[model samples]
Target chain A: MKVNELVQKLELEVLCEGESFFSDIDGCFAGDLLSLAMSNVRAGNVWITVQTNMNILGIASLTEASCTIVANGMNIPDAVIEKAKDENICLLRSEKGMYELCLSVGELI
Target chain B: MNSFKVQYTIDGEDFSVAGEASRKLKKVLQSLGVDPQIIRKATVAMYEGEINMVIHADGGVIDAEITPEKIHLFLRDKGPGIPDIALAMTEGFSTASDNVRELGFGAGMGLPNMEKYTDYMNIITEIGVGTTIEMIVNTSLS
Candidate 1:
């Protein structure tokens, strides 16, 4: 499924617009640990985490993940949002917890 | 074949900027048309090294050499050296502080992951002096 479709289906907020919202989602990875996430998350997967720091963008780009969904309605910093735009990484915000987000993503993809 | 080299200095004081070097390297590799799989391996290995440098070492320097056949990375730090390389190599071993863990790292998988992704890895360290790690990912690998 494309990211925009998933965003609309889940009612996710676009924290920052990336290069494209039409990127394909291959899978979902839920974690807060950056190192573990980088080591384990598959490319083209939707990364689900509460990490709102700028480093997440680096991890997302490095892993080639489709997009990152910040769970539980956390506030992502403006600098991070700017970096996301610069890196062309789609950043999404979701009010659902990580578990619910994963379940919904699983159903969609 | 021609080669390209880049060097970066990691700041230990800031946890926010830990993976910058690896991210830059990934972009360079992508622009150079390196295989995606190979780029992933190199980026993961080097990013782990960068994290270790920030969490363990006060900071460090990374020197990367990219060539047609392989990507070589050298990570050096002047932090308290690893007292036991073997134990440190263990998957669950970590000396990072609680604060570091709060930042979403220090699971003790950094070195192992680096070794796992790279075709070759070497570590050189001294008790109170520093540590230097060299890792190579062969682009020829399929």
Candidate 2:
């Protein structure tokens, strides 16, 4: 599934678009532990997490996760959003919790 | 590939700039057209190491030695040297403050993750002095 379709279907809030509009979503991974997530999230996975720090962008870019969906509507810092833009990693936000977000992603991708 | 060393001075304990070292190195590798998987491995190792520097050592220096065959990374920190290297290597063990955990790291996976991603790894430290980690990722390995 492409990211734009999922964004519309899931009603996600796009905090930063980067260049991930049509990027393919290969799978879905949900984790908050940065190291664990680093070791686990595969390339092109739509990673869902509650981590909104700038470091999350690092993890996302390192793992090549297609997009990061910050769950529970967390307030991502401006630095993070700006870094995401600079690095071209898509950052999205959702009002749902991690579990619910995973459920929604499961249905689509 | 020409052999060269790229060094970055990690600044302060600021979480805001935690991963710049690794990120910049990743870009350099990309510019060199390094393999994507190799780049990911190198970046992950250095990113975790960079975060450790900020969280525990109050920042440090990361040097990437790029060559025809591999990339050698040197991470040096002058913080409280690790008391027990074995314990620090164990997964899920951490000495980071609560605030560090709140930033979404500090699950004690830093050193282990570095080992997992690189082809060769070594550590040198003195309790009153500092800690230095050397990791190698060979481009020809995979």
Candidate 3:
């Protein structure tokens, strides 16, 4: 699923679009723990987390994650949004909490 | 097959800039046309080490050497060393503060993840002195 689709499906706001569009996601891992997420998530997984920080972009880069969904309507810091754009990592914002967002996205995937 | 080297200083006192070195290394490897799997391994291993540096030590230095044969990484920190390497290697054990946990790391899997992805890992530390970790990821065969 492309990030645009996710944005539309979940009614998420586009905080920033990194590198245009990524068409498909292989899996989904919803976690904030960097170590566990890196070890368990695959290259194309859509990372769903509430943490809106630059390190999230770093983790996305390491894991080659397709997109990052910041859950619970959290405000993303400007520096982080810029970094995500620079690194071509898509960033999305969801008003829903972590659990519900994961469940809905999981159903889509 | 030529060798490339880059060095980065990690400030352990600041958690915000933890993975800068790993992020740069990943980009360099990608540009070098390294296999995705090998690049992923190197990046993840180095990232774990990078996070450990910030969380445990005040910070440290990460030296990355990339060549056709392998990727060599060194993370050296001047912080309280790990007293029990065996226990620290466990999956769920973590000495990270609650504040660090809230930032989405310090789950106690740093060393284990680094070890899992690299072909060789060496950790040397003295309780009061510091800790140094050296990891090698073979790229030629993989």
Best by TM-score, which number? Answer: 1
For residues A1-109, could you state the per-residue lDDT of candidate 1 as single tens digits?
9999999999999977586588888988999988889987888899999988778988888888888999999988999888788778889999999999989998999
Candidate 1 regions with alpha-carbon error over 4 angstroms? none
Residue A3 lDDT in model 3? 69
Instruction: Give the DockQ-based CAPRI class for model 3.
Output: medium
lDDT of each residue in B1-142, candidate 2, tens digit only: 7897899999865787788788799899999989888988999899889989988888988889999899999999998898899999999999989998987789999999999999999999999799999999999754
Question: Lowest-scoring 10 consecutive residues by lDDT in candidate 2 chain B?
Answer: B12-21
For candidate 1, lDDT tens digit of each residue in B8-104? 9999998887888888898899899998889999999999999899888889899999999999999999999999999999998999898877767
DockQ of 1: 0.79
Clashes of 1: 0
For every candidate, what is the interface RMSD in angstroms? Answer: 1.2, 1.2, 1.3
Please report the candidate that would top DockQ against the real structure. 3
Fnat of each prediction, in sequence:
0.82, 0.74, 0.90
Clashing pairs in 3: B12-B58, B12-B59
* Model 3 lDDT at residue A52: 83
C-alpha local distance difference test of each model: 0.90, 0.89, 0.85
Highest lDDT among the candidates is held by which one? 1
TM-scores of all candidate predictions against the true structure: 0.95, 0.95, 0.92
